[model samples]
Target: MNKSKVLLLKNCSTGLVSQVMTLIFQFLTRSLFIRYIGIELLGVYSTFTSVLSTLSLAELGFQTAIVFSLYKPLAQRDEQQINDIVNVFRFVYDCIGAFFILASLALLPFLKYILTGITVTNAIYLYFLIQAFSSACTYFLAYKRSLLYADQKDYISKIIDMIVNVIANILQIIAMVYFKDYLLYLVLKLMQVIVSNIWVHWVCARLYPFLKRGKINFTLLRSLFSNVKNIFAGKIAAYVYSSTDSLVISAFISTVQVGYLVNYTTISQQLKTLIAGLLNPITPMIGNVLATDSEGESKEGAFKLYAVMRVLIAMMIVVPFCVLINDFIAMWVGAEYILPASVVVLLVMDLYIHFVHSVNVDFINAAGLFREDRDNEIIAAVLNITLSILGAKTIGLAGVLLGTVVSQMWFWFGRSYVVFKLCLQADKEDYLKYWLKNIVDGVALTVSIVFCAYLNSRLPIANSYLKFVCSGILCEAVSVALFGVFHFGDPEVRKMLKYLVNHIGKR
Candidate 1:
């Protein structure tokens, strides 16, 4: 087995545990949050986070750039180069944090105009300030965490996050039960943020004890800055993609609508984060491959990974949306919070696009292909913002989501093409052939799973938990069968299946 792949799996395993912990905690906390903060403040909290996400453009993609930069130097164990990269990022992050605080303060007063139909609270500005402080602490001190990731120690950070999240959330949940104050809940969160940041900083120091602060080398910094510029654009575009729906809905519709949307979105985001954990560990490993592997090998490996991921993720997403989401909303939140099928479909499509983006972006970032797709990212962002505002004015929530999906389609193609042609140096046919096959396989799996879910739904299952379980099992079995047949000819699929069988036999 490849050592790097082993490390990736290890990180993924730990990350998975963390995400499961998070999901459990979040589920427990949601009722308390809704009770204490009420639906309106919940909307305010959602809007606040969205606004913060929008302003995170100040992060300027240095996280990606610095992490990308460290892959090579860390591979060589060149402490000097690593130190320079860290210092460069530290300096950049410090400035970014300071700038964000200033700009957000300047913009806070205008949120009155920006967010309509939402009653502003006296503690609103205080909430913003505390959240900003949390964000600033993260930006200024979290740069070292990237160093750990580049060194394949991301499990450390994930573990720390898990512990911090559990402790902080338990305390916050208790505070909410008693005080029912958003401000106090946020205060608990702020304390947790500071603790998490400090803990990670300490971990980095312990891991790299020999390292000390140093100025960035001019030449290396300039080269890295070139990559950072394009990455910054992409980061801004991504923030807009993720944050715009709440902003649009809060402004045009109502805060209550935003609350309703987030009820479903909370599920979407949790699933997204959980599944995304599986991809994160592999990304820096992808950078290693792009840096070291031959062109043909890199192309073949990337295509296989992307194809497998697409098939797996499609089955994961589409089946749930089909069999589970409607009843899920009814059981989890309420039927009233469930949107029209048209809107849910749009939301699922958006989720799918972003999910696949994880795969595309890994290769692109790994190959340092930022500049090639920078213009496309900018255009996508512009189109999304413009169309979202216009569409929301006419049609409301669904229209805003549709605008995002349309814009994602715009640049998703560009990013994939650049990865195939520019990064992997492969033919368009090389990409299209496998991509088409994987998408077809995924669609087939989705149809089969949905039918299974339909049949499962007809059975006498009064308990929603039992219903979810029955459907989940049926979907998985059907998906496995479909995947096995569709990918019978692919070596990667065969290898993984054989490994699974052998492992099971051994067990």
Candidate 2:
């Protein structure tokens, strides 16, 4: 195998392992929290985390901007340029840390208003303070990890994060079992964040010793600032897009409803995280390709193959999710906790849209086309918030989720246009053809999934767990068969299969 392939495999293996471990620990922790601390506290905890996530915009998208800036330098082995970029981020992060602290404090006074479905008086403030400070302190050293990512050493950071999270989750479980104190739980989480950031920083410092040397390059800094400004706008939109669901549910609906949604979201988010971790190893590679071969035919070919893989994965995941989620949720929590069928369907549909479009988003980021797509994201965010609020007021949870589906469809179109026109330099006809093909694929997958769901419902399994297992198996089988029939002649699919066969034969 080639060096790039070896690195890609290594990164994917480590990332998948770490993400699986982390996901297991997170589910365990969440389940324990619900069992011991009660659902109200879970709701409160979810709300506070959402609020703090909003505060994360203080980082101002610097990590992404810096990482993009490093791709070229790293590819060229320009240590001096790498150091200059890292130092600029280090300085900016320190300022961001201070700013987060101040902003968090200013927001503290209004926390009471956001505190719905919880009766904790003064302790909540302390919890927020610790969480806020932990978040702030992360900026001081977390910038180093971006170096690892841009250099295709993501496995190192992933491993460190996994270890830290495993230890923290174990400790938090013990605290909940023995003391039943949410305060101790939050502190444990805080320590995990600090340790993970510091560990990554130390690793980067050791791996690239020159990271400590060299001053900021004013020319590069000016360019980075431009990217940051554009990326920050997208960052705001992203935060609004993902983070506001819980907050909106808390305010417009209730925190308790947010808690229930969290149960469903937990499964979906973990799946997304796992998929992202497996796929993210390829991002820096994509960035490297864009840096080295901006106009090369190889880049476009790679993108087409990637797009096919994403569509296939999305189909596979959404099918099982649609068929088995309600049963899984029933088994994981209780039947009462399972969301309304309409809400569940909308959630899965939204997830499918995200999975399908992720290829374009990743390419857009790799190509550093944030400036071109900034307004697109802002518009999507606005639409999401507006639709979500109006929907929540009118139709409740389903409406809120429907807003996400609509916004993601908008994002899908906009991002595809940006990637084809700007990044790939493809013409309008080519872009429209590619866009229409993906839409057809999405629609076809939806039809297949609906059939799979109907088949699952017709199964005669009586036991709930057995039914879930049977439903999952049926969904997987149906999805594979349908996609095989649907894309039997797809060149990308054939090429991927041939590569896989060759790889296994070599093994």
**CA RMSD of each candidate after superposition:** 3.3, 3.0
Q: Whole-model Cα lDDT per candidate?
A: 0.79, 0.84
Model 1 TM-score on a 0 to 1 scale: 0.87
Worst 10 residues of 1 by lDDT: 298-307
Against the true structure, candidate 1 has what lDDT? 0.79
TM-score of 2: 0.90
Candidate 1 clashing pairs, residues 3+ apart or interchain: none
How many angstroms is residue 461 displaced in model 2 relative to the true structure, after the best TM-score fit? 3.0
Segments in model 1 whose C-alpha atoms lie over 4 Å from true places: 1-10, 71-81, 210-223, 281-298, 301-305, 356-358, 423-446, 449-453, 480-496, 502-507
Model 2 agreement with the true structure over 352-380: per-residue lDDT tens digits: 88898899999987887778898889999
TM-score of each: 0.87, 0.90
List, residue by residue over 397-434, the lDDT tens digit for candidate 1. 88898899899888777787887788778776887875
